[model samples]
Target chain A: MTEQPILEVKHLQHIYMKGTPLEHHALAGVSLKINKGECIAVIGHTGSGKSTLIQHVNGLMRPQAGDVVVDGMDLADPKIDIRLLRRKVGLVFQNPEDQIFEKIIGDDIAYGPFKMGLPIKEVRDRVKWAMELVGLSFEEMKDRATYALSGGQKRKVALAGVLALRPDILVLDEPTAGLDPRSRNELLERLKTLNKKENMTIIFVSHNMEEVAYMADRIYVLADGRNLVDGTPEEVFVEAEKLREHYIGTPDTVEILAQLKAKGFAVRQNAYQLEEAANEIIALL
Target chain B: MALPLIQVKNLSFEYAVNQTKIPVLHDISFEVKPGEYVVIIGHNGSGKSTLSKHLNGILTPVSGDVVVNGWNTKEWSSMREIRQKVGMVFQHPDNQIVATIVEDDVAFGLENLEIPPSEMKERIDFALASVGMNEFRNRPPHYLSGGQKQRVAIAGVLAMKPDCLVLDEATSMLDTHGRNEILKVVRKLNDEGMAIISVTHHMSEAAQASRVIVIEKGRIIMDGTPREIFQQEEELKRLHLDIPVASQMARKVQSHHHDFNGTLIHNDEIVKEVVRLSQREVPVI
Candidate 1:
């Protein structure tokens, strides 16, 4: 038997300020299915409904039409517990400052598990685990003032808070948007470890094609609140013309190969990794 | 030769926590000439944002000087003049936007200087036109896309008629399309003889800059052209930073075939070089 999807959305539709002059169709007939341990990326330009789609994953936004199911719980069911669903899917917003509240880092990260009524010892243990997972030392940084930390540290604290809940799935919206190259790479590596070692499903919304190419095993392209295409990074990026039509760009690796092909060089355009793209060009030479 | 537009000398900054002062920026010095496009890149908490704040008097140095157009930021009476000479745009567009309407938002800065209504109108028009947001002037900022909102923010700063623009991760919160929009405007402004100092972590953005400055642990560690800086790929990786993908790919190809000599940072340059190399009678390794 085929493995069941951990999260599934079918023909999802949403309209902002419905029936008013300022109403906007934010999502229209979008559909996607994600496996339990998969790392997926939803990429689109501004106003492309990527944010709206993720909001539905954790019950932040109910389906205006169509259906959403997370871990066998149907969102359309009136008796379904949103609180429980949120615990299963941790969603991190774009800005770390938006979610952080406690002055101390440890207390902030412990908030989620504490609210769940877990034992005090378990809460502390979970906070320690989450902090270490995000590369923050529990001993050194747990007492640090949240406001005094750098942008990267603040983001780590926010992520640790979400991870402390021990969610089955982690969703991040532009997780590396404002981070430096080092921090961005470190965060991506942590997420990969979560997916590989813990079997945690990862879903992220991003505008950075390079990040998407590096982290996503499966890719979904969105445009105008609709699912434009879905496939592996190489498959989606090879359709460069289609992505450009929607104001999306391919990763630099694929872009350079495509440019060489346009210049009459016999180079492969499907390479998404730097080493692979380099090999393709070297072969041509 | 044109006089320097801004100069920083022996700058040091510290943030006061409960009872202790924590230093965030070391003794730093740099000079930006007129019409120069300089990009400051570093890992998060490397004092890049802290340094950018000093340019416009947002943060006063503890033991150093920042002179803008011959006016010292340390002088209280010259603050207004210094601010008018150096306008800053921050990361988030929503936080920076004040007025409900786009045109009014652009005019807000002009009115602060108590400019006459006639001159205010002219300045607002010129500012909006410069960012290509004149058509959205009457619309609500909330209704605009992220890129459009950022353009509006830049217009607001432009209305002040600043000689230098300091962008502190201004494009960090924007999508790829939005980033491109902002870069296009910045490049055009620099072409028109306006000095720009952009602080960001995006190596691809740094590739477009005339000069690249790398900061680490609150100190300026490297300063040179993009080509000069990105060529030291090992050093950048050691600092937890990354060169642009195009540059990385070029180096990888160079490793396989020892003939590629030049340091190519941009996509087009790499693509052209690859095509030229493919035309040569070099054997693949």
Candidate 2:
């Protein structure tokens, strides 16, 4: 909607283990700009530098070449405060267990504000608010052991921990990876609220085609450490051959449409939903 | 003509958690014949992963019989042999891996058996190639994506020369592209007569398999070919599992059209079916 983007990654190149037998050029000259309040999904086959690229956004890793400019702050600048950056752009990793350190749910949620040197009252309020954000009840789960929570609940606690930090941009690496269906939907709904109500910029890394179709406003496909395609979900997924070549699978709806088209059927190639595709075909005949 | 690849009879497991023997699984029974690609579906806490673990002696049953290659699970001597017969790839490849180098990780399981070093390299090469990880044989695990790491995990097991491969939510953490890559590898392995038992929540993934088994609280609640299992649209939804988006569309269209006749699964199939239905003249009142 604007000329300047909320976040700009300019010619970002990342090389792990710079000069040794184990050296890896994980990313090579990747450049893209993400606007504020954007919900972008990053999809790629394993070892495609998706994780590497996202880590750079939060200053977790420094790019060997190029830089990530978030809110006009240069990621590669040595003088930049990584702690402040981490607070603004929260990154939740693949496993919930990795960051869940507190004994109880409430303490875990408050860990962020506590670390940020907030007053005790402020931390307490944030813990309650963050738990509510992820749909964890204060009366039921506040004192429960973090270890006792289900996989889905643990993921929520992790999310609550991030939310307490008041991040403007949330970068999640497989946030819904291990969740149940209800929990996944609930998390997505909460995330939609965060993106809309709180106006948090969301860059979610996922491989679930349906989730991507349902959630992402824009998508970036990666392969062999390169940005393969960048477009809206409808456009990026419509090119079946390109997706296949890049190891990205089309959404189930689109895949079905393509299969029908291949079998001497009259399904519109653009339909990315069963109902829409069915409607398109019905209208066609 | 030959022994079934794997069989489970009233298998149950309980572990002592805080002095209470919490039953993670109840009485569950299933069987996998050779060349069968079976997918077990369930929500979180439905015992899908626990069931997959029991298939390969990763977790021995406490109450029932698990027989692999005619070897009873209770027979202590069969533990190693059973594991050798049924290879496993876990949900998180990072935890499953035991080595740094890709080829070495592939060769890890074989090396565990004290296989002759001379032949180990060949098996490693073949296994790496099987999962398309051959080119990255010398790469470290940290440099790869979640899918590639999982593939290497699969190759490690492949090098062990197992006949049945049980993936316990293996693709749960993978993004769409990574999931597809793993699916292709699973299909390839199954086609080559490797009995595959994948425990997943993704119904779309189950659509690729020949048979789907839905487990609930440690019981085989639903079991049939993909077509048969998915046709039970209502039951799957009750279990909190999603029907393929195409099926949902079909159900929608079928409700309004009194004389619609089409058995469609993929969205494209819905498109084809709708096209056919639309072209039909209106029925006589």
Candidate 3:
């Protein structure tokens, strides 16, 4: 808490279709502080303001009210260099089609660095490095057709395209969605390595509690455009009863442990991961 | 025995672009019995979505045939009959809702079939109530959560009075809570004797169905009861699919203590196993 957080949002508020009959408050009084090299997950129902909040992190959508500061750059200030800020903080949308446009994989990845006016060698280096980082072979994938790749490969390409910019902070919206379990695990592992090796700040929005429990260093639960809870996975998941009030769901591990606790068993209710809960229950036996 | 609700015979599909035929599904075949809940799982690009499109006559097979409720999809005239018999719910709920109000959206499909005004009203109310969205009948589609929106989409399809429901990754775009909400509604409808065919990426969701079908490389690779299919964990992993978390945890726990002997799929099953072992004072280091 003492260090200047890498990303901070103060009382963020947003209203969609403002001043109209269909007007809706997408975000309301939401605040967050995320540190460098930490992987944070924002969990909420579909309309719980998760997307709206993350949209503000990279200044994709300006907040109607409130403030967002990324690495000392205030998003509320119109004078700030919005383009430069985007380079420092990359945002990957939920749909792969929305991100991948170029026919060739290499061209799509080089788009960001090319747009930055980086030298030819630097852009080529970044594209190669990103492809390798996401486990895609540069030589093979660079010239391959983007649409011909499988779903998992397309997602990897999308991720590599964002990583090509070498952003210090990366924000992804449902990065593992629509992927098989193996691909989901692979993507999570790649992100963990980036966070550990590059000291990258990761802020991802997800609805999968199991992934959040496994990946997030800190978790935030949003409800009705408000910050319902924010804590470590263990702290937030153990509050099963409270979470239900916000329509928040927990992973199967936590749900099982909570059920045992409610049934008067001498079980550890705070275990969030399956292995941790499994080990705890084994000890009880 | 009653005729299978749907039957696919050597179904094959390919995308024809500029005289190049790119195969998406390969000789896929299956049958869904009345009131049965079947879940199809596969890695992305495994052609599960393509298969779903064939069930409702959205896409015709290139070299095979699909019969839905005794209607051949190949016949252009039977397209309407096939579509009406097999109500399809897609991944994005936002795309399916055609009306501003929930009730109006539910009535849209019925109106297309030229149902009488009195019948349309009754169908709309019944469909909304079936999905537990009757209370939000007056609300705008934009105002509902992802899960609620999906339920409303289901209601829209339900009003068509389909005998079988085919969900093509319908819950993929939702959060855990939203996904569960959709699954619960689907299961309830199945219990009410509506044949349900769900295509999903979530391993846990597949574990709950009456049957699990695994598609790989555009073909049906495996199909059996959940226990039968999940027992082949190594094979599933080879296909880029993951076993349910509880199933994996059970294996991990069994590695330490051989007392837990069962194919655990649900969280409750693992909890019960641990509880049974604890009563017997199984040695724990």
Best by DockQ: 1
> What TM-score goes with each of the models?
0.97, 0.86, 0.94
Ordering by DockQ:
1, 3, 2
lDDT of the candidates, in the order given: 0.91, 0.82, 0.88
lDDT of 2 by residue, A1-285 (tens): 356676898778988778999788889888778998999998887677888999999888876788789898887888998888888899898886678988988988888899899999999999888888888888889998877655767888998898899898999998888786766877899898889888899998887777888888899988788888889977887777788876777776677677767766766675775578657545544
Measured on C-alpha atoms, candidate 2 has an lDDT of 0.82
User: What are the per-residue Cα lDDT tens digits for candidate 3 across B22-132?
Assistant: 989988888999898999999877888888888888898998889988889989998888888899999899999999888888888887789999989998888988999
| Candidate number achieving the greatest TM-score relative to the actual structure | 1
Task: For model 2, state the Cα shift of residue A260 in Å.
Answer: 4.4
DockQ pick, better of 1 and 2: 1
> In model 3, where do residues sit more than 4 Å from their true spots?
A15-25, A63-66, A147-153, B279-285
For residues A2-116, could you state the per-residue lDDT of candidate 3 as single tens digits? 8999999999999999999979899989999998899999987767888889889888888679889999999988888998899999999998656799999999999999999
DockQ of 3: 0.63
How many residue pairs clash per model?
0, 4, 0
- Candidate 2 docking classification: acceptable
Proportion of native contacts kept per candidate: 0.92, 0.62, 0.80
The alpha-carbon lDDT assigned to residue B173 of candidate 2 equals 79
List the lowest-lDDT window of 10 residues for candidate 1 chain A. Answer: A259-268
* True lDDT of residue A193, candidate 1: 90
Higher-scoring candidate on TM-score, 2 or 3: 3
Off by over 4 Å in 2: A1-5, A18-27, A45-48, A62-67, A148-150, A222-229, A239-241, A260-268, B1-5, B99-104, B111-146, B256-263, B266-285
